[model samples]
Structures are given as structure tokens and as C-alpha cells.
Target: MVPLLKRFTVFNLAQCEGLDRLAPEPAPLPERQIIPAAEALIDATGADFRIGGERAFYAPGPDFIQVPPQPAFREQINYYRTCFHELAHWTGHRARLDRDLSGWRGGPAYAREELVAEMGSAFVCAAKGVVPTVRHADYLGSWLDVLREDNRAIFRAASQASKAADFLLAFEGAPEGQPAAARQSHSSVQERIAA
Candidate 1:
């Protein structure tokens, strides 16, 4: 069991303008530290990530994720990256962040959700010292379509992804030098999302 962020936490968006203004970037953690930190965060979510499936998906009703095992991936990092992507979807469960997950596969809403998961996974990987790859690079055309249709699409996706990352990182052992303003901004965004 890991530490949990206070549920229903309140944050102020106006004060978050300085979120990314940390004086100096913190030193990266050793490679060995990354996996364990990711595992801890996944564990903290209380969602089961099963390895028996060939396709990866988040089951909102069950509050669980299914991903293919390590051998199914081209690299070890990919396995966990996919896991985090699915975990981002897990955050959208009704009891968690409560995002709308009713879109059909390959639909506009699906592409939007994919954007959130990819960005959220990148944020989590960066937090844990893992360099993230564009796992869903094939989705770029669809993503661009969405962005073209709405100027604020990327902004909303990034904001939602940040909130998903913050929600999971709340279980990590330490804060990893993330600015309080940034964390608070993420919380504020989460509050907005839930509303």
C-alpha cells in the first residue's frame, strides 16, 4: 500500500500560472528506479492489469486493464508504456475522473481519448525517468483531424492527460520535485473534468 492524495482535493487555477517555472530541473533517477515507481503507481490505482490478453483495453465496469505480456511487445519499455496508456483510460472510470468513454473504436471520440492516454502515458513515463515513445504514432492523422476541427482540442487533451498523470502519481513514494503549483493546477483541472 502506498500513500494516497487526499480525495476531493481543492486547487486554484488562477494561482497555477507559474506551474512550470521551477528554477532548475531535477536530476534524473537511475534506470532501475523507473519500473518500480511505475509499478507502485499502478498498484496504488487498485486496478488489476492482467497479461493474458492480446489486445489491451480498460474495462470501466470492472475497473481493470488487460494488456499483452512482455514477449508480445517489441521492447520491454513498450510493455509498460502500453500499460500506462491503458491505465490512463482506467482513470476515466465513472468512480474516478468520470470521463465519457462511450465512443466506438476508431471514432472521433476514440481518437480524442487516445490523445489523452498517449499524453498521460508520456507524463507518467517522464515522471519515472523513462523516455516515452510515440506508441500511437499511427494516430497522428486522426489527431490532426481533431485539432483542425477544434483549436482547443489539444489543450483539453493535454490538460486531461496531466490530470490523469497527477491522479496516478499521487501514489508514488515522493513528489519528485514537481512544482506545487503544477500539481495544484492538475488538481484544479481534475476538478473541472469531474464537474
Candidate 2:
């Protein structure tokens, strides 16, 4: 058995050996390339996107997404990240994945849905070759409460998130000159997601 506490030496990286041998971080993709890709994914969903608003949200009733203009974001990637998060919610529409979204804001059900969306966004971002970050750090406390109360909550959320990501990614690479909606049936994707 290992001791609960163990003494260890700590040293600054500047004084470490072979520090100069480390490789430089790869350059991030330009917004021009990344933004269009994200927009294309959004287009594939065929969901009405309304740009120009102080907040970003997906309206299940109207089956539409609304987000602030790109200029409102400090980084362009952040704008797409927000869009992806909202898109995850969009996938839960009754006609789509049919996830329960009746929870009021800040309620337990809402928090659970938020957790799924956050992970879904991260999955989509990773699939699109972008590193994902927590879109809503403010939800940490509620998320912890959710995980603590239910041992299997994380697993369920992760499974749901993977489904959401696959649903969105299925729209990618539609045949040339073919409408995205026509390229793949929503039912088929939903069945796969459910599986």
C-alpha cells in the first residue's frame, strides 16, 4: 500500500534538463478555414440560424438556433464553440433525438441536459479537429451535484453526448449537388444514435 502523503522534489521547468529539446506546439487552424467548416456543419442540420442576439440558444419549439454575431466574441473560435453547444441542444428536438427538455432553467433536469450538451459540443469540436474546452464552467457546481447524486449519471451523459455528436457529424460530406437533408435520413441517424 502507498502512503497517503509522500515527499517529492519539485523543480522549476527553467532549471530542468533537456528543456530546450521539447517540440513547439502546433499552430492552430485559421478562423477562415475553421469557421466555414463549422458553418457548413450547421448548414447540414438545415436548422434555421438567426444571427444577432446577445445570447445563444436553441429554441426547440421553433426549431431554430440564435447566436450573437461573430464580432461579439473575443475569439472567433469561441463563437463557433457556442454555436456547437447550441446545436447539441437542437439535436434534442422532438423530431430528432427526443431528449426530455422540459426542465426549467437551473433545475436538475436542465443541469443534466446542460451536461450532455457540453460534452456533445466537445465531441463535435474534437471530430472537427479542434480542441474542446468547457463551454459553461458556471455549471460545475450543479454538475458535481448531479454526478454525486447519481453514480451512473456521467456514463449516461457521455453516451448521450456521443449520440449527439454522431448525429451532427453524420451531416458532414453530403454528396455534391445534393441537399444535406436528403443525403441521410434523420431516422437512420437517430436509430444509430439511440443504439
Candidate 3:
């Protein structure tokens, strides 16, 4: 009984920590949406997760997601679940996907974060070879509530999460929205940003 109780407590605390990682703040704008173009792997698998058109987010947890092995990750696939979860969060960083980590992340903020991460995970799982685990139904109610409360939450979170997903799929050497030819054009964009 003691061991079980301790495990339960630990799980709850860890979940709280995960939620805190994406603390919200007020911003000048609602943040920009990041979208990746379709690729061969995306086409072959028939699993392109469209944002703006619908909702999106990453699902964390081992479960054998498929991707080429690289220096960042030891093996071809990761067994640790939370790592993927965080990687999913990291994808929303300003430099990569430019996801808004600020103000009222749509309601509980935490709930919106979870929704995006879960959606991203599910899509990546299909690409990498992991099975989609059971998503919590309890959150569905909260998610809907948040969406209803904030119409833009669904759109922003989905857009940001999609870009994050594309950023994480860097091993494929594919820049989400950056076309091979557009790299030069974006050079000016980058310069403007730098200025």
C-alpha cells in the first residue's frame, strides 16, 4: 500500500512539472503559425497532420516512434516517454517553430499544451512505428471548454504544434516550411528578423 501510494504521488507531481514547462505570458501578437510542407515519407505513410485545417499536438512516451538514429538520441527509437513529451514541447521554441509560449495559452494553458503535444505524438507515432496509446477522455472535456472559451486557442495551438513537429523531424533534413529554393529567399527574411 505504501509503495503504491508513493508511486501515485510521484506521477502526479511529474505531471505538474511537465505542465509548468510552457508557462504563459502576455504578448504583442498571438504568435505566428508554423507549417511544414508535405514530404516523401509523409506522403508514403499517408499521415500528414494538417494544422489550421484541424487541431494538432505531440504525444509523448516511448512506445517506439520511428525516425533515423542521430546524435541527439542514442538509438533509432527512444523508450523514455517524457523525453518525447519534452522534445515535443521544445519544438515550440521561438527559434524553431515560433509557437507562442505566452499569455492565456487558451484557458488552463496547461490543457491546451497537453492537447497539442498529444496530437503531435500521435502523428509522429504513426510515422515512426509507435501505436497510439489511449488519450485521456477527462481532458477532452477541458479541451473543448478551453476551445469554446477561446476560439483562437485551437487554431494557434494546432499551428504551433505542427511546426514543432516539423522541427523535431529534423533528422530527415527537411525544414518544415522552408523549401530548398526558398532558403535563399528566407536569407533576407532572416536578415530582416535580425535587424
- For model 1, residues 91-142, the per-residue Cα lDDT tens digits are 7777667777887377778777888988888888888776544545565455
1-195: candidate 2 lDDT, tens digit per residue = 577988889988778878766756776545442566777787777778899878999887878899987766656677777888898998888777889989837677787788888888888887776653444445544585866778788778888888888888877766533445533666677676556
TM-score of each: 0.67, 0.73, 0.41
Q: What is the lDDT of every predicted structure here?
A: 0.71, 0.75, 0.45
Q: Least lDDT summed over 10 consecutive residues: which range in candidate 1? A: 174-183
Candidate 2 local Cα displacement, residue 186, angstroms: 2.5
Give the lowest summed-lDDT range of ten residues in model 2.
132-141
lDDT of residue 151 for candidate 3: 74
Regions of model 1 farther than 4 Å from truth: 1-34, 133-142, 173-195
Clashing pairs in 2: none
Tens-digit per-residue lDDT, 45-92, candidate 3: 222232221122332222122432222232313322223444555455
**Selected candidate, larger lDDT, 1 vs 2:** 2
Q: Which stretches in model 3 have alpha-carbon errors above 4 Å?
A: 1-81, 103-107, 136-141, 174-195
lDDT, ranked from best to worst: 2, 1, 3
Candidate 2 at residue 70, lDDT? 72
Deviation in angstroms for 130 in model 1?
1.4
